[model samples]
Target chain A: MQTFHFDPVDLPPGIPAFRAEIRAFLAREMPRDYPAEQKANCWTVYDADFSRRLGERGWIGMHWSKTYGGHERSALERYVLMEELLAAGAPVGAHWIGDRQTAPAILRYGSESQKQRHVPRIARGEAFCCIGMSEPNAGSDLASVRTRAERLPDGRWKINGQKIWTTLAHRSHLIIVLARTSPADEKNRHAGLSQFLLEFDTPGLRVQPIVDLVGAKHFNEIFFEDCIVDAECLLGTEGQGWKQVTAELSLERSGPERYLSSIALFFELLRVVGPSPSESVRQAIGRVTAEIWTLRQMSLSVAGQLARGEDPYVEAAIVKDLGNVFEQALPPLVQALADDGIHLEQDSDFVRTLALLLQTSPSFSLRGGTREILRGIIARGLGLR
Target chain B: MSEQRQILADTADRLFADAVTSRRIEGFDAKLWQQTIEMGLPLLLAPEADGGAGGDWDDAGAVLHALGHHGVPIPLAENMIAAQLAADAGLELPSGPVSLATRVEGALQQAGTRFDGKLLGVPWGRHADAILAVVPGHTVLLRRTDATSLRHAHNLADEPRDDLIFDNAPAVCGPASDGTQASHLLALARCAQISGALEAALHKSVEYAQTRKQFGRAIGQFQAVQQQLAQFGAEVAAAMCATRAACRAATRGDASFQIAAAKLRCNLAIGFATSTAHQVHAAIGFTREFDLRQSTQRLWSWRTEGGNDRAWADVLGARVCARGDQFWADLTARDDAVSLT
Candidate 1:
């Protein structure tokens, strides 16, 4: 049996001061009365100015090389900055995709021209990017993506397909899309797929908002009707999109964000429970505290593995699987333990936060990757498949 | 792991494998205990000046993890703790198995050089050469043969958890040293044990799922079984990380929060790990003859040995709640602020 390794990772030197700096930045920038409801979905809260401020601090794309406008900081330092932001419920949506997914993909797989064009803009928080992997039919079976990018005779690429659940696509400056560049191979469905980078302002491109149950319009559906781009837009080698996108997922799945989504609600719950709580309430609080603390350690361990240039794909999947369960279970557990006033007092900060999380928490397991898909990955890691 | 820890872990893995084979899962295994003593395993945490290994808590934790992983039936963790506590208090102990008791039913009255009290749930008390108890202000070591009466008991794993009564039993006493409390050390020990046992259980379940056929194919092929085992793997991972982090934290300094959190997380992992292991293994796992029972039963017992989930949860939750808005700040401050080499 293949065993999972999450060796304990100590935060590197200067992390405490780095953490304090982020805390101070958040305290200074974020309003004291920032709505609790908004904080519940803080990462999805788009604030261009806030993201720009973080970029100004050299916080975005922190682990990348300085040649691409990155600060060349350690992954652990970036981890500290991220957790501090999430804990404070800072709005990081505007640069979230670009800094987390696009810039890294470009740095690792993109040509020098591609990296120079996108990575610097991303580090400066001037260009926001949205992912284009999922389609109406390709949710978890991402290998079945049918979006096509055909190389034109004139050495340009023409794209045509629809990408669904593309977060903030309408507002994003660029979209990194996974499309089939050739006929799919019967032996390997993952073959023939390629990734393309396109500006949202490109011709024949359209984005429509998909409102969620919480009335949030962050999710978007992008239509590529022969969207044309220069040949330089093709990311990495042709037909290696599967490998490239899968690599990006380890980054997406293992970060502190996976577990800290509902931290705002947690802090609110603690504040409401006060110093002295009933035995049951105390136990509830303690259970969640332990869960979050352990998850943080697991996340950090994965981060350390990544910094050391190890591919911790299975470990990353485990983190997301456990983290989503912890974050998703928090709202209801708090509801059962908290006073009924949360249900009646809709205007109160605690109630508002709890209500928002109750609706949004379901998406925690749905987005990124479904619980079933993540489990499949972990099961494969266990040598079960 | 450091090279020193790697050597210790390898030594422990070999020692436990040779000493506690599958045939001797239910009893003390005196031959194994003798080998353990020969290796100076019990003095792993004692200072070098005290004629001991002088290893740190992480080293001891690595040994305990191997013990639990192999389902070794011995009081090695207890003995290590007892020897270390004795060394810390400047008290000399006999070179034999020594069980530790942090939970005393009543006060250990010290009159001159004798002591009287009940040490509750002393692990392998009847078999131990001596029992160490950390009282209110003193660390007291008493020979098991001096006990007035002994009520022998066993945990779910069939490990001895005897209660010993002492009435004016001749004992060595010294002032308790500052640093980690006995209860915290015990809890951390169990965390390491549970973390190891969880891995064992996960290993068993995954192997079973792959081999045990159902519906004309391996059950592991089914998404349902795979998902369950995957969740089991995750719990095992969490337990391992939490235990290792707590042990590392203990070696540095105050680890109240890490120990409490580790114990609580390990306790939670035990529930899911054991249940999932059984569910995946089906009837073979439920029987007494299978080796899975060794790891699963130990997990069941160890979850509550040091302090149960509710106990540690209370400590951790109260601490976070008391911090109020500063909880995040307090949590972040727990990490060391050292420079990178």
Candidate 2:
């Protein structure tokens, strides 16, 4: 039996100072009059100015080496900053993808020239990146992606495909596209796929907005019509997109962000519930808090594993799966507890936040790999599939 | 894991595997309890000068975890709590098994060095040499023999949860210096213990599912069963993390909202863990003849022993509400700032 390894991780001495620093920075810089529902939408908030400010403070790429314009802080310090930012509902989406995924991906597999070209800009938050993995047909079954990148005679690649659910693609400066570079093998569909770092401004590329349930234009459909990319654009070796993307998903999965999505709503619920709450209300709040705390611990443990250079894919999946379950469960539970029948309006932050969360939180499980896909990963990890 | 902690855990694991078994626990083996006491587990959290191992809460949590993993049918956690309370109060530590109580149905009133009241659900009270109760400003340590009478009871695990009455019994009382409330201490202990039992349940369920075949293949190969086990794994992991974090707080004598949250979370986890384990094993897990009943039943029993989920939830929810806008700050506060509201 392969048990999940969520060993308890003690925060290092640097975490407290880092936490205070981030909290203070958020206190000073965060928009104070935003709607409470906006707090629940913190992760999706694309404030390039705030992101630039964070980068100037060297908070964006603290874990990266100073040679790449990073501060060379520990992973735990970065984790503290992330948790504080998420908890404070700080807008961090502008440079989030680039800082979290693109920088590391470039550092790990990019050429020396590619690293020098992109890594420093990413650390400086001067550039933004978006994931170009999911397509209309390849949402969860990623191996079925049909976006083809053909080898050109001029030592470049011509890509022709459409990517759906491309978050921030409309604004991102770069997009890490996963395309089929060769014919797919019948027995191994994961083969022949490769990753490419395509500049978003490339010719024949288009991004169209898709409004979500909350009437927010956060995601978009990206079209690549014979887009040309130089040979230097490939992220890793050809036919290894499956492995590289799988690794990247780990970075996307296990984080405080997974569970803290609805935390701002939670705090608003607390404020509305007031000092005296009924037994059921108390239990409801307690249950959510317990679940979040546990998920945070698990996420931190996975972070520790990542810091130690061990791939905790299964462990990360479990954290995301469970974290999503709790986050998704919070809105309904709070609604049932409030039982106020109050209309959603700006006058009542609690009522408005609750309504927004109730409508939007269903996507929590659907967004970061659906519940079924995550469970499949867990099942594979358990050697059951 | 540190070197010393690993050694302690390894030793405890081996000792538990050898001495504590289904047959021994089903038969209520006194020798197994004696062996555990002889191994110096009961005094693991006590000071060295008081005939203890002088270990911290993390080491004690490891021992309790080992005992819970093996489904040891003794009040080892209770004993450790009693020993620590006694030692912390500068009182003489007594030999043999001891049980600690925080929520007695009847008042255990204290006057000078005497106490009078009925202690309900006193774990291992029938077998314990003494009972330690934290009342008012003092920790009252009273002998079981001094009790007027004992009404023996059993939990789902068939462990002793006796009711004892003390009619103005003499006790060695000391000023409470532990700072942590008895409920918080016991909650922390049960959190660790339940985490271990939850792990064992998941471990056993996964093993059983892999070997137990269905229509064509192992039931574990089925997506339904695998998903259930995966959910169980999540609960177990959550319980482990929550308990360890709460234990860290308890070790620093900071009985914050975390203790209540951990207790509530772990109790809730045991519900899922036990149900999923039983569902995975089906008939075999339901029977006492099999080893699954030991872990599941204890999970059922231990969850309510030290402040059940509802009780602890109220504690946490009230504290969070009281803190009001400071909820996040308090939740993320350092150990020194985490006293019970």
Candidate 3:
């Protein structure tokens, strides 16, 4: 038997080609007027035309079914494309969540009409979706959502609740909301809730931007006050909202993207600062690289499991738990590397990247469930109480 | 490694639990040793030609993992590795309790045509049919009956480990050369054993943290405890990683620098596991009556033999700095390559 468990995963075939394609497209079509700071900021900036062009290449909904205008690619294939784009600072920002998570969930459990209406436009980059799960009262406690959706006399459901931390809601065309249809249902607290594809411009719908500590307009608080929607806007089945949302969170969490977000920095660090590194620096680099490789293997193992159609919830959590640490480690590590006179000042592109990542890495733990919560999940799965 | 090993480990574990109690260790558990020999363990290093399975590092590591898992008291690593060290040195290794002799430079020795020296901490030396002790110019293979003084220097693990004082032992009982003999081979073998013990300890720690509850939760559910187990697991893994890498170097006949690395890494692992395991096991672990005592105690002693961490680290540091020379680099490239199954 082979002793070494870790088999280094290549960043899928066609990645280098895809990378070239992205570079060529960005060079030719992208405006030279883009601020140097904004360009350096990478995929966080939304450019609809750039996203639409990417969608024209069938890159937006690359992992969805071809019938829905998707490219009909493997998750790994989509991964290679997205990972390369993210690493190279491609403007995937506009279509990021729509293609990454929301579209996939809709395809899996959305109504046929919902798929027909949303997916084609999503593929064409005409629509963007942000998740509506976290509410004012429920941050990590997702099941405690009180976003009530009551059936009205006009036969439309009226949703009246406020959701906080709704990323990109101001820019997104639609938001997938999980609302409680029956708070009185004792049989299942989670069962009475249902998901909906809500129009961002619906009457009584308002979005207030929540500026992060970094001063980026990344997330928002959305209030739905008597916002009525036809029953056709209902996603999947009623009362399966909690189960559906949990499945959606799985899509949010697992992937090489979780760790690969820092690779560009790794590449940059190696290039500008190779040879004759200090003992501590060399050891740190070696240690971090080995761990990165290990995390990649474990992540691929989970991907392989997912490819085989296994839910692999426990396995996925294990990868995410470990992967997040690597992500969270990158900024501080890059800073440490930068501190050795590598020059990570605001004016330097390297410094700009470092500043952005260092500002961003802390939230890696916050984004996909907190560190403590995921460890709890792992402990429970391992039967370690 | 896990599937085949779990079965072997589980089997031996059940039997070891029955025999080899604390009382069995202070005395010669001859029946258990005979049982292990019958079970084809002692011949582990004896090669296929010498009525042995001819298993390498991993095979031995698996058995050691199993032994540590159950706290089984038998010199699985020492007996076999010691025998191989003598064979590789081209001297007939006397079976049943032979000690490999170390040669120190700039040291006073009675200058004589007959190579005479004393060997210390010889694993299983007092019970051996023959002993291979290295003098300045020769690996003098001595018959146990021929040794002047062989006293049992009591070991933490109840097995027989002794210092063999030699007065004119026989020279080159086997065919290998004297200049070719080195303790690097012994260090590599000993490192494998220590790595196995570390892995076993981590596995036990994890198991204990998982099931043993405190204040209505598994101790592992506590982040402090989880962090400890996690770090311990990583250390054990790193040690195994280095050990397996060294094994690959040995297989490719590039065993110089790797021996030091494996020993150094394993030494670090043994210290951590022996200590952390008790923290997980807590008070009940203090009982020599408990199985945890066996593995932890062995870890304490193994660190002292075949050169300790300080000595190995110096050797490791010296070799690593010199590997940049082109010829040395090419020679040592394969040294760092190990099968990390």
Candidate 4:
């Protein structure tokens, strides 16, 4: 049976300085009075200007080739940039998907024309992308997607289906839709599925925002009614969508964002509790800190694997699974250990951040992929499946 | 892994596999100690100029991991640390088995080269030719024969953990070496052992899951069983990674944070790893005849040894909290000695 490997990775030289640069940028750009509650959901807080500033600093697509408007930095450098942003709770939502998933997918599998048009715009923070993989009937069983697309004799592709729980679809400039180009084969449910890149302005596309439990409108339901796109819109091979999307998911799952979601609240907890805390509180903080520190090492190991061009999907799944549990548990742990000075009724930063995270923590495991799905992936890696 | 380290690890693993028997689960195995001494395993961290192996902490970690994996009932880690400490202090080590003790009760009084003190929880104290006790600002090497009395004790795994009382024991003493504390080294040793033992338990659980039948199907086929094993695999991976980080940090200087984090992380993983391994095996695992008990019992014993999770967590947490807003900065300031390609 294959075993999991997460070799320790040391950040290359100059990374410390690069980290300082990002810290300086955040210090200069982020508002001094930015509320902790908003920072708790910073990744979902869209700020086009903030993203553009990062783009200007070449932080977006910093690892991609300069041919596509990238700066051609190392993957470790990009990792440092990303982790600093997440750790500081900077609003990176506007171009997060574009920079993280879309540009990478395009660079790896998109047509030259697609790369030329989308990669630069993404790197420039002028375009935003939302994934359209999850459907109303296909939450975890992703291959059960009922969205269908047909190629017309005139060479344009027509798409018809609905995608639910699509984050930021309403505000995104583009959508990467996974559709069945042909009937699903009984022996291979994953076959015949194709990915397409479409502009939000497409005539037959409609997006409706869905309010989350936290009253956020980032989640959306997208409908594709006879949406037509040119043949160049096909991403990668016609029927290799499963392989491509799973690769994207690996990139999605292992980043620092998975575990650092509640970092803002963690800092707030430290701040409110002051330098001297009770033994129980200190123990709680210590436990959480140990987890965060270890998770960062795991995440960095995966990042190093990616840099070395090795597929560590199983390792990534482990990180996401462990990270999701840690993120989801942070709020309640803080609530259980915090002093009585901080309560839900109070409007203090600690209280507000704690409340927001408590409401949003459930989605920490739900988004990207659910805990069950990640464990299934890990089990497969362990040769149990 | 480097080629040299890999060879050392393989050799250690083979030696440990040969040494560990169902009957020798407790106490020192003299033949195994003889073989290790012949192999110079105890001098792994001593400088080459001192006629030692000149191996670094990483090399020692690889061997220690193997020792733990096989549940080798020996004081290899303790002996290695003792030899390295003696070498660093320019003290000549004794020929036979050497146990280590960092936590001594009361003061280790030194009057013109004679020492007196009580060493507590000393692994293999009665079996060792000499015992190395690290008191504040000094490391004293005392012959076991010089002890006034010995109280026998054992951990949950049945390994000898004795208390030795020394009254004006003739000893070789030297000033404590810089950047090498007996406690931190011992903690790192425990972390490496926990890492290896966790992996062994995980391997056993996975193999059992694949073969054991339930409801006319392999129990591993069940989603419930698969998920538990998957979680087990994750804990094992985390322990391994954290231990590696700690080893690497120790190879560099000032590894207080990494060591504390790694030990705490390993301590936390032990609970889940032991429970899940036994849970997956069900009733068979609970039997003393089952080999799974060897790894689980060691894991249980090692978790509390070399400082438990609460102790390390309190240290790590207080340090970070004391840093206040600089917590993130301190966490990110990497002290790794290697460069990424």
What is the lDDT for A304 in model 2? 87
Deviation (Å) of B126 in candidate 3 = 7.6
Q: Write the per-residue lDDT of candidate 4 for residues B230-255, one digit (tens) a residue.
A: 99999988988888888888887678
Model 1 lDDT tens row, B1-341: 89989898989988887765645657587878888878889888888899898888899889998998888889999988888888878899778788999877545454637887899988888889998888778888889999999998999989999999988789788889653488999999998888888988898888888888979999999999999998999999999999998998888878889999999999988888898999998888889888899999888888889999888888888888888898888777776433332
Question: What does candidate 1's lDDT look like per residue over A105-161, in tens digits?
Answer: 889899999888888889988899888889999999899888899999999999999
| lDDT pick, better of 3 and 4 | 4
| Tens digits of lDDT, candidate 2, B229-258 | 778877787888788777766777665677
In the range A1-385, model 3's lDDT, one tens digit per residue, is: 1111311222444544555565577668665665434533355568888889888888888767888999877776665566546555566677877886788888999888888888899999999889899888887777789988988887788899999888778899988898888774656566787898888889989999999988999789999888888978888888888889988888777766666665656555554455545555554554454455345445655565665576766556666666677777777887876786666554765677677777777777777687666666554544555
Per-candidate TM-score, first chain only?
0.98, 0.97, 0.88, 0.98
Error of 1 at A243 (Å): 1.0
Tell me the lDDT of model 1 at A263.
92
Q: Over the stretch A114-144, how does candidate 2's per-residue lDDT look in tens digits? A: 8888888888888999999999999888899
Evaluate model 1: give its lDDT. 0.86
Better of 2 and 4 by DockQ: 4
| DockQ, every prediction | 0.72, 0.46, 0.09, 0.62
iRMSD per prediction, in order: 1.6, 3.5, 8.9, 2.1
> Considering only N, C-alpha and C atoms within 3 Å, which residue pairs clash in candidate 4?
none
lDDT of 1 at B89: 88
Report the error of model 2 at residue B309, Å.
1.6
